[model samples]
Target: MRSQLRPETRIDRCFEALKREGRPAFVTFVTAGDPDYETSKAILLGLPEAGADVIEIGMPFSDPMADGPAVQASSLRALKAGQTMKRTLQLVREFRAKDNLTPIVLMGYYNPIYVYPSEAFLDEARDAGIDGMIIVDVPPEADEELCLPAIQRGLSFIRLATPTTDDKRLPAVLANTSGFVYYVSITGITGAAAPVVSDVRAQVARIKRSTPLPVVVGFGVRTPEQARVIADCADGVVVGSALVETIRTTLGTDGRAGPDTVSAVHRIVHNLAAGLRGAAARV
Candidate 1:
């Protein structure tokens, strides 16, 4: 008998499509409304064309403690430019108006969503075409707070598994994780250090044995070469801080986005996508 068909989401189809192409996905992260709205909109619209398979839009927050310096600065810039949780959803709505295929995942802490009152935000998110979530603060123990509710609403609640996620804890992390598992290559804050390939590979392998979800490694992945190395082992690779830093450095003297800001981020995504492609060709 044929196996039962599983539900397919934009994120699910994205990984499946990349699997057929024999390549790891290149995921891009951008803080919505960083510096300003129009500039951030340009970056979001250009990402897919620039070779991003999936996009993670960060909800600008004040105390982004888990984020490293680069990402924290991005949040501040967005907040300074008047980016609100409501505006963040509008960014996704605007993005959905152009591209219907590339999956968009909202990555952020839980406070903003809690303030939005879980149900209302989830309904708005679904309407805005968000495919998944990467809430760093919500653990399996507290899945009822967000994860379970998100899943019930047909949204993939992607979970993060770190090198410190031992075997005993792996099951809890994977218990309700959907879309794909974001394997943080480092234990500390995001982008603090580079990830060793061997260590990442071993951890990815261990996580896979616990769940069938595609493991995508992130954190400390900055350059295209580093992306290629991580892509060689995992199902996908994520680059955030480096891309955020590009926006941070490219801002004008007055602290607004520069003329080349959008193009600069597109270039970063393009090169990383190329790296993943090159790695896939090798495989």
Candidate 2:
């Protein structure tokens, strides 16, 4: 049964829809205003049609500690291109203009939101049609500061459950986590190494036992086959670094988005989505 403690959100609706289709959600992440605003906006607008079930827009910050090299570089590009918190919210608003069904979750550190003054940022984010948030730096113990407040404002405060999150520590992680539980498939930062499918299966099962929320595995996933294997065991698959790398590869010599940037990224997403759909068909 779905948890009744929190209100039904777009993120909830997305997973429910995927459940009905018997497939795992294909979640994609990209840095807002990477390269530039227009190019980033174009990529955001095309994701849903390209097979992305949920979109995570990285709120560009100077020091993104939790990210790997690819994601960290993407953030730097966005910041160098003048991406700000306001611009990030603007990207969401533009995406909302065309896509109301797809869930948009802002993923980043706490410093930006903290300097945005937190409360005002939440109000603006909600108004801009953001569905949830994955603030990597904030913990459950600091719920009073942001997590609880975000939940109060109808935004799902998603939490990350690492491989090291044992049974004793699981409850606290799930206590305030809504939307879904993001199971970090590996220990280190995003895009470290390929996770062993059997290990991922065990950890995802462990997380499921503790929470009613859907469990989505991420971090080491890079290819369509990997997405398929991971989705076979988890409720969803999140691929970030791979897609960001696609953007990097397709850029022009001067580092701006080339003609193939949008299409290349979409191509990867389409293939990943196909992989997840194939997993569903096998079931």
Candidate 3:
């Protein structure tokens, strides 16, 4: 239904192709300019080849309240390396020059976009080959300010449904939500701990009964086995903090990204993709 009216975007195309393939998508996330731009770009360009169906490019902000320690540190590293809203979008632009098929979603806080002029930012993002967004601080109540405008420009405004989103509040959360709904399986911040498989399965079932949009479970998923379990229960599985932690491990003594930074992330994504692929085959 959301796809019928909006311009055909890479996000929609990617999900549709997965439906035909009878497999769940493996979504990946990384901070732009973490340590430096070139290294982050290498990770970005390498993800899809490593089997990432959708990539969430985080825009580095000075104050990230919703992020966990790992993600917060990554944001600080990116900002220290000069990652701005302009630079983040520019990274997507550079990525689009070579690969235009995999969907890229901008995920972060709202302050940067609001400071950049909402309409102007949307125009530039639409031109930059961005497919969707997940602004954590901006809720459905503020749709007029950013959400609606983004949808009008054909950008999918992905909403987050957490463990606290009850049946009463679920409708409001799903109302303006486009693309796919991100179901945070855990209650706390990112990189905390793995969620119970049965609880997440029940929540995914509940959300699916309410909305036609795909329900992707994320947060606290740190292993290939965990990804496979979540993929079996939900429409997709998103792995972020664990992946960012890998980047952290690859940093040198000076905190600069080492030569193996990109390769480290590639291995994680490769194993996760293989896990989901195997799960899909079993189904």
Candidate 4:
């Protein structure tokens, strides 16, 4: 019998498509209105054209504890600029208008989603063409009531598995996780510190044995070498804090990443993408 596709099938398809083309998918993240709406929009639009396989649009929230200081600061800037969940969805709608193929995953803490009825949030997400969601704070036990509806509505619930996730609990996490599994490479929050553990590859291998899902490693992955190292064992690499830091440095007090921002972003993403592509090229 043919197996049913995951709820967020587009994301799975994108991963497979990139693999077929001999490239480890590059998933880039940016806050929805980081510096301002227009620059955020430009980066989102430019990503796929510039070689990004998937885009994670961060929905800024008041308390982003899971994120490091840089992402928290970015979200604060977006909030101060009057960015709301409504505006973030509008960004997704605007993106869908031009590019419908590249999967877009909305990543953020759970408070904003909790503010809205789950059904309303899922419906709006579907209308805006969001392919998946990564609610950093929601564990699988709580997701049935809080997130399953989105799965029922054709959106992937991407779960985050930490180094602390053991064999007994890992299956439960993967059982509910759809699209692709997000394997946290470190023990704590997102940033450029060296990983807390030395056996991430072993952790990834253990997770892969439990399910047939594509595993994407994230957190503490800042440079091309780090990306290449993770890409060697995982399906993709997620880079957020590092890129956000670059944008933060580029932006002056005026809430803009300055004139040279595009060049800087392109340079960083290009290097990350190249590293991801290296392993695929050899395949």
**In order, how many clashes per candidate?**
0, 0, 0, 0
Write out the backbone clash pairs for model 2: none
Stretches > 4 Å off in candidate 2? none
Better of 2 and 3 by TM-score: 2
Instruction: Report, for every candidate in turn, its global Cα lDDT versus the true structure.
Output: 0.91, 0.93, 0.92, 0.84
- Model 3 lDDT tens row, 126-223: 99999899999998888899999998888899999999999999999999888899999999888787899999999999999999888898989889
Q: List, residue by residue over 1-283, the lDDT tens digit for candidate 4.
A: 1126543377988987877876777889889987778788887888887778899999999999888898999899889888999999999999999998999999998878878766788899988999889998888888777668878888888999988999989978987677889999888888847663348789888999987878898998888888877788788889998878888888877866688666677678988888777767766
Cα deviation of 275, candidate 3, in Å: 1.1
For model 1, residues 3-85, the per-residue Cα lDDT tens digits are: 01336899989999999999999999989999789999999999999999999999988999899999999999999999999
Local lDDT at 158 for model 2? 94
| Model 4 TM-score relative to the real fold | 0.95
lDDT of 2 by residue, 1-283 (tens): 4258667899999999889988899999999998799999999999999999999999999999999999999999999999999999999998999889999999999998998899999999999999999999898889899998898899999999999989998999999899999999998999889999999999999899888889999998999999999999999999999999999999999999999999999999999999889999998
Ten-residue region with minimum lDDT total, candidate 3: 1-10
Off by over 4 Å in 1: 1-6
Using all chains and alpha carbons, the TM-scores for the candidates as numbered come to 0.97, 0.98, 0.97, 0.95
The 10-residue segment with the lowest total lDDT in model 1: 1-10
Residue 108's C-alpha lDDT in candidate 4? Answer: 91
